[model samples]
Target chain A: AQSVTQLDSHVSVSEGTPVLLRCNYSSSYSPSLFWYVQHPNKGLQLLLKYTSAATLVKGINGFEAEFKKSETSFHLTKPSAHMSDAAEYFCVVSVFNDYKLSFGAGTTVTVRA
Target chain B: GAGVSQSPRYKVAKRGQDVALRCDPISGHVSLFWYQQALGQGPEFLTYFQNEAQLDKSGLPSDRFFAERPEGSVSTLKIQRTQQEDSAVYLCASYWREDNNEQFFGPGTRLTVL
Candidate 1:
């Protein structure tokens, strides 16, 4: 019954500029959060995860996300966008004890020069 | 590759045809999952297996959809008399029990129903 809603369907950012992809969730219980990225013709890869240990979670490739309980958001951010960062990103939710995931619609990121 | 892998990376089936998709999880992974991804959308969970036991199949769309991991390593998702709505990318993921938080994904098998 839990789900994630991605605020932006597409995001465009210039190289070296900051990038933000928003996500919100609706869950009856406190849930673990994750961000996964899918590059062209490749499999989905884990970017980072928030498992209640930290509000701010750092991930691979200079990416990070913050879990805000008040806002019900776990928006992904990067200080400087790289050309390779252009890919489809998904916000995922998993409940305590149960590892099956619920995914957001996804946000397509495009990095320009 | 060290990552998960799915066979028949692309499959095209006529309506009412039966199709089977295969998934090879990373060696020693204890948990396996199946998901469906429609065009322009994120993948949706379909089923889960722990070792050789089928745990949760609540996400499966219909009874026509069937999945199995008899030996607990390789799994297959079979669709009987497929419909147009079944056209999507079938994704397979594997999770090592030690790393409970992350799931490694395979390059999904794109099933196209005509």
Candidate 2:
């Protein structure tokens, strides 16, 4: 019953510009939200997670995400883009008391020099 | 010390051949997971294990896919009669019970069935 939708399949941003990758979710209960990043030929790395705590969550590499329950959205953002930030990003939602996660299709970020 | 580890970083199997993949979780981790990721897509859960118990396998595609974590330390996923559709990256993840859903993933095995 829980699912996540990533709005953009691909996003391009110039270096030093702000970046936004939108995601939305549907869950029957209060859910745990997460953002993960995967580089080419690498494993997924956790960027951040929200477990009913503060609405705004900060993550590694100057990345952050805001959890908006009203909008059913948890969109990831960064103040400035860097070349190393280019990767595939996934939005995930996990139901309360459940260990399994439903992942979005993913957003590919490309940072331009 | 070490994060999750998976064997056979890449494999190419002929159709109808059986293949086995391996995973070694972090020391003393209580949960292990397997997922399949197609090209240009997010990873999809294939199965889950808590300790040595196979708790959930609802995401496995068919009866030909089998997974086991016999001693609670290492796990193996076996696929019988490989098909072209089965070609994808297989990922393994694990985390400690106290970590509260923080799953660390290994570099996945890229399987290509021809």
Give each model's whole-structure lDDT.
0.94, 0.94
Q: In CAPRI terms, where does candidate 2 land?
A: medium
lDDT tens digits, residue span A1-96, model 1: 689999999999999999999999988898989999999778999999988898999999999999999999999999999999999999999887
Clashes of each: 0, 0
Top of the candidates by TM-score: 2
For model 1, state the Cα shift of residue B70 in Å: 1.2
User: B50-88, model 2: which lDDT tens digit per residue?
Assistant: 999999999999999999999988999999999999999
**Which clashing pairs does model 2 show?**
none
Candidate 2: segments with Cα more than 4 A from true spot = none
RMSD (Cα, Å) for all candidates, in order, is 1.2, 0.9
TM-score of each: 0.97, 0.98
What DockQ does model 2 achieve?
Answer: 0.70
Instruction: Report fnat for all candidates as fractions from 0 to 1.
Output: 0.74, 0.71
- Say which docking band candidate 1 falls in: medium
